[model samples]
Target: MKKRSLLFGLMATLVLSFASSAVADTKRVLILQSYHAEYPWVTDVNQGIRDALEEERFTEGDNLTLTTFYMDTKRHTDDAWKQAKAREALALIKSLSPDVIVASDDNAQSLVVRYLKDTSWPVVFTGVNADPRDYGFLDSLEAPGHNVTGCLERERFQGSIRLLKRVIPDASRIAVISDNGPTSRPILRRIKTQATESNLNITGIKAASSFEEWKQFVREMQTRADALVVVTYHVVTNEKGEEVPPGEVLRWTLENNRLPEVGFWKWAVEDGLLLSEAISGFQQGYHAGTLAAFILDGQAPREFAVTTPQRGERCINLSRAEALGIAIPRDLQTVTTLFKTQRVVK
Candidate 1:
């Protein structure tokens, strides 16, 4: 009886040791974001990722370890600086040796994933504006076939245009404006194609890299076009050759522009754009986080198909509409999310 009790105690100790080892086996994930933490869009994406991880019971610093690196590419637009930052990120990745890497937005994919492509490490990306094929990350959307897969932020140009038509029935001509950046170029191309395919007259498509140029283009469009479609102005440089904050550009437009403005991002509606059929940044990150979880569970990234946003939100700025004397349709009010206050000023 004594011998049997001693054996039972040894067995219990071994079992407890194994359980502790299993609990201590934490999986590490690295999230590489192209923009800063304070940027609203990036913040939403991060929130989505965190929420999804929480749903999976992957608590950070517990069963899972998460490390995030923000390149702040929006503020630092110089090519040389971007390259240096990419090198720094790569070094950090080497040190971390994370099990999975999540690259968010165009710059992160362009700088980090592009370098680590076809490697043993798996990469999941979100908020990629351009075709993954354009960056040689995949053979086709249907089959990534290797280690990278995530979601694409399809530009909602046609949908936003249709909504704009509903808001401004008599408006015949429109101008599409965006910063002349790598990410914006692909979006502009799609917008132009959609404009050509639709019935609405596209007065012009303007890409402005500098703040002074952006203001000039807006002023020109005010006379030449009935409405303006804002894409993104996050990377536009100011008159002093410094990167201009997106809020500053939106505020300038709100104070100066006479025509109704529409956009593809929800933040634009909050920032005083008249209306938008906006893509949810949070959804993009959530889907990407889901994919990351799959990878963490030993599923290959290639096995999960690349996905696009399943839904778009129709957002209206009521205060801006009232200020412009444009009456919102009763049906639109029922279906759309309305914002009364300007989220950004000056």
Candidate 2:
């Protein structure tokens, strides 16, 4: 009886050892999203990350654990609020002690990855519009030369401009309109450069932070510019000087604006813009997730190169085109995703 009892005890010890080993092998990933959870752009990017993680057989609560933090920076634009939220995010990161960190968008990169660069934990970032060099995150696109690597959200200005030209053959002078937000600044610069190269005269570049200012600029552009290229309106304030929702801004712009409109995001087309050559936010997150997976699997972030999205979607709003008395080529109709209403596809 003594011998049998000892044998059972040994088996139990071995089982516990194996269970502990399994737990130790599990990887923990923390995702830092710079926008609200309800934001479609944020949700789409999160979905892409989830899909990529699933592809690697990383199931949550089993062999992989995933945690997410949404900074809600889009709604709260004040410097003090942002600083406080940054501190909160940093504290959370310290407590979690994640194995890998995946940051999404410019705010995350600026707020979280900026402080944690070259640390023990690896970081992969996506949806950054500003040049990575601007933040000293990498030596070059080819090699990060640090413990950070991921995809850059290249401005789709040229493609969208080309599409706009195709649809509006007589459009000579164009005006670029965007809110005076951090994300739009880099993109607006790129658009100005591309506009000059494309030989399309830039009549005006209006960066407005309030509804009245945006309306005034749009009214001016309607009379002078042949077409309007809307970048983003997330930071625009309403009449009361309070922050307004992007959807409301788009709705107002669609109802009031007269010029043929084009933009870089697919959702813009659904939101009343006439055409777009959209960069996929989902693919950006997927690439970032791919980098995170590599780091979790024992590969250094420096081993992987920074990437730019290879695919773009041609999106057109047929109803908006018709409303503006513009004609879309038959070939474009055959190849592009056409929407008749303001309903956006996720």
Candidate 3:
């Protein structure tokens, strides 16, 4: 009986030790987004992260503990709110001490990761539209000498414009409009450069700060330009300086604007835009997630070079095409993804 009890005690001790060791060996990661989870970009990026992590055999609730934090700057773009959310993210980071942090978008890098540099923590950032050096994240794009490195977002401006011309066959003068936010500023510049290179005439460009301003801009552009290129309206605000919901912004724009609208995001086509050569949010997040996985497996962040993820879907909204009185060329149809009217503006 004594020997039996002793044997049982030994087995229990071994099991306890093994459990503790397993827990100690587990890797933890934290994904930080600048926007809410429901945002299509955020959702796509997160799915990419999950897929990459799984490819690397890091499954959450098994050998890895993954957590996510959303700053939600897209919904609440006030200056005070931005600071508060950054502080909130910082506090969470301090509490969790995750092995690696995956930050998505400009707000995450500019607001949160800016303060976390020169630390032991490895950070992988994705979907950064701004020049990364502007945030002081790296020594250089080619060789990031810090514990931070990841993916950059490249909008397929020329490709999308050429495709738009093919579909419309007469869209010479373009009017480009986006919100006057830090993230959109760089993209606006790039679009102008692309237009010049492609010899496409750009008649007007406006970055509206408020919904009223956006509406006015859209209305005026109808006469000034042949086609409308909608880049982003995430930070468009009300008179009270609060961000207008993105859905309202798009619906209002689509309902009122009758010109051919070209976008660079899948959500735009999914919403009601005429066409887009969309950047893949999934590729952005997947590359960042791959970097995070590598860092967790003892690879240094600096070893990876910063790069632009591959271009995503070339999409045409059939409903939008019908409304605009344009038929998608069958050859173009074969090359690009097609969407039915997801939302009826009328």
The best candidate by lDDT is 3
lDDT of 3 by residue, 24-132 (tens): 9899899999999888889999999999998999998888999999998887877899999999999999999999999999999999998888888899999999988
User: 1-346, model 2: which lDDT tens digit per residue?
Assistant: 9999999999999999999999999989999999888776788788888878877777788899899998889989888888888898899889988999889999988877888887787888899899987777788889889988889898688888788889877878988899999999999898888878888899999889898888888888888998888999889898788988787788878888889888887777877789999878788878888778878888999988888878888999999989888889999899898889876422
Give the alpha-carbon lDDT of every model.
0.87, 0.86, 0.89
Candidate with best TM-score: 3
* Model 3 stretches with alpha carbons more than 4 Å out: 240-242, 344-346
Question: Which residue window of length 10 is worst by lDDT in model 2?
Answer: 337-346
Compute the lDDT of residue 89 as modeled in candidate 1.
93
Give the range where candidate 3 is weakest over 10 consecutive residues by summed lDDT: 337-346
- Each candidate's clash count: 0, 0, 0
In candidate 2, which residue pairs clash?
A: none
Report the Cα lDDT for residue 211, model 1.
Answer: 91
Residues 250-279 of candidate 1: C-alpha lDDT, one tens digit per residue: 888888988999888898899899999998
Error of 1 at 78 (Å): 1.8
What global local distance difference test value does model 1 have?
Answer: 0.87
